[model samples]
Target: MLVRLAVIAAALLASTGTAFAADAKRLGRYGEWESLTYTEGNAKVCYIATTAAKVTGGEKGKNSTFLIVTHRPGSKSNDEVSINATYTFKKDSSVELQVGALKHSLFTKGERAWAADPKTDKAIIATLQRGKEAILHASPAKGSDVAATFPLSGFSDALASADKACNIKR
Candidate 1:
């Protein structure tokens, strides 16, 4: 099941016509975090994925909820965060990521939310590096709002694994 889900997640990030293998290499596992690496054409793709530890106030969808921090060296996209709400988000609404004393916003699209730009990505990654936990809040289009919490115990290690997998520094 994880293999299948990894393929789907990779496909979601692939450019048009790009192909990804169904199985992704397990770079390492750190508590709730899992570092995975795969290939899309000639580019190396790496990401850390984790299931939400808690979810509140929304009906569930068929797909499981997850959070990912991806690195795509070919596109210079590193430490890019994306969350799957598992439910549609209200139009024009945003998801909030609270990490330690910092609160960052992610723009929504369908059931997925992402950092607005490279600056926001960098900031969020920086916070995740030192924060103990992160909470993702989502407002569904037609249902109740949901808040999902992710532990950060192994985030730094997972992130380092991703960087190594993608041959990225810092």
Candidate 2:
């Protein structure tokens, strides 16, 4: 009986360790991500969070959207989400962003370019960053840079704000 109990304890410990390792790997690769869509003048800017799954593109290696996992601080429930923002690099090295059904192009050479939702005509600008994680910031763009640098913390806030402003429940 003693030997059997010891074996069972070892098995349990191994399983627990595996579970923790899996969780850590997931968090490290993809921090929580959110999607947002906002407008500037007549252009609409869409923001999406990139995920490990999409980034890796499976074993076949296909281009895919980013993925986000969200959990409230005190809530027991968690959610997995994704964002769709089409990007096109311009001849001038600027980028165009299309979120959901809205579209906007940006030029960061001079000051900042104005974007607006075609439907609402609300003006906004987006800042895109790519490093360990990809981040896009959507704001009024009036006094903001079309392409600005931001830290990881700022990226999280900008993502959340885009979700709120774009009326994206997911």
Candidate 3:
């Protein structure tokens, strides 16, 4: 777990648009997931993150992909889901997140994708917590289709840690 967290921290440090990741403090690691907290302009942000367990197609091994669920108490935002892909997404495209029999679409912007609304975010989080894995299907701006799989082994624990840190109720 330490090695994996190290690798994830390295990726986070090297990535762009991570908000205040430089000041993020580790909460804990559960399975393949990790929880952290950071302050963004005086607002505390608690989140859980996990890298793609497997990526296939479209420049597969060359991109960095991860899934994140964040909470912001100041804004009353909870269970905000975001998927980050190293490459820019196709213009006006939507990414598909599938977990077990549940499927949802997320609007794309640059390298990130998100649920259409807070309700959708909650739905996605619930699905993720109950499922074992999630598969994201996306189309990049300059490449073929890609599918990234994320294991949900520690998702529940990670989210719990984030929620506790943010003082969010369920």
Candidate 4:
């Protein structure tokens, strides 16, 4: 369907690690999350995207912040996690993500952060499904330390939409 293709395209764009506006269709919305897909480079990509419920500290820039779980069929990086931190990270500093009682250390580059490996990505998703919320502690290059909170409500449903949209299992 046209709408489905749009969702795929949007997801692809979201996970691309670059800044760009998407002109795509949304597949669905699950609580605080959204299911999106879109076309890029002739390939379909699906992802679940959400914004933080609250953010504190860190000097302002564009202040564009969000999280994404993306699937690119037949690619090595499928089911990856990406975060837009809204500010460039300190050189060689990692972000700390706390969900419930678990904590994960994420690698950072510029204004983005992500799980260090595919296995970690899967683990983060699993935690997202069962945890209350996610709070990320980060240090920006030019500002004070920051903490961003993202609610876990509807994460499972959002992931299901992404999986179905991209023909991914689990």
Candidate 4, superposed: residue stretches over 4 Å from native? 1-21, 61-64
Of the two candidates 2 and 4, the one with more favorable lDDT, higher being better, is 4
Clashing pairs in 4: 7-36, 7-37, 7-38, 8-37, 8-38, 9-37, 9-38, 9-39, 10-37, 10-38
Clashes found in each candidate (C-alpha, N, C closer than 3 A): 0, 19, 0, 10
The sequence of per-residue lDDT tens digits that candidate 2 reaches over residues 8-125 is: 2233224223322111211111133333332323443444333222232111222222322222222322222222222221224343444333344544322222232222222222
**Which structure among the candidates has the greatest TM-score?**
3
State the weakest 10-residue window (summed lDDT) of model 4. Answer: 3-12
Better of 2 and 3 by lDDT: 3
Best by lDDT: 3
lDDT of 1 by residue, 68-139 (tens): 888999988888898865567889999899997799999997878899998899999899888888998888
Question: Candidate 4 on 26-87: residue-level lDDT in tens?
Answer: 87888878887776576777778777778887886534457788888856458788887556
Q: Which stretches of candidate 2 lie over 4 Å from their true place?
A: 1-47, 51-57, 63-65, 68-80, 83-155, 167-170
**Relative to the true structure, how large is the alpha-carbon lDDT of every model?**
0.78, 0.30, 0.86, 0.77
- Ranking 1 against 2 by lDDT, winner: 1
TM-score for candidate 4: 0.86
By TM-score, the better pick of 2 and 4 is 4
Residue 43 lDDT, candidate 2, scale 0-100: 40
- Whichever of 1 and 3 has more TM-score, that candidate is 3
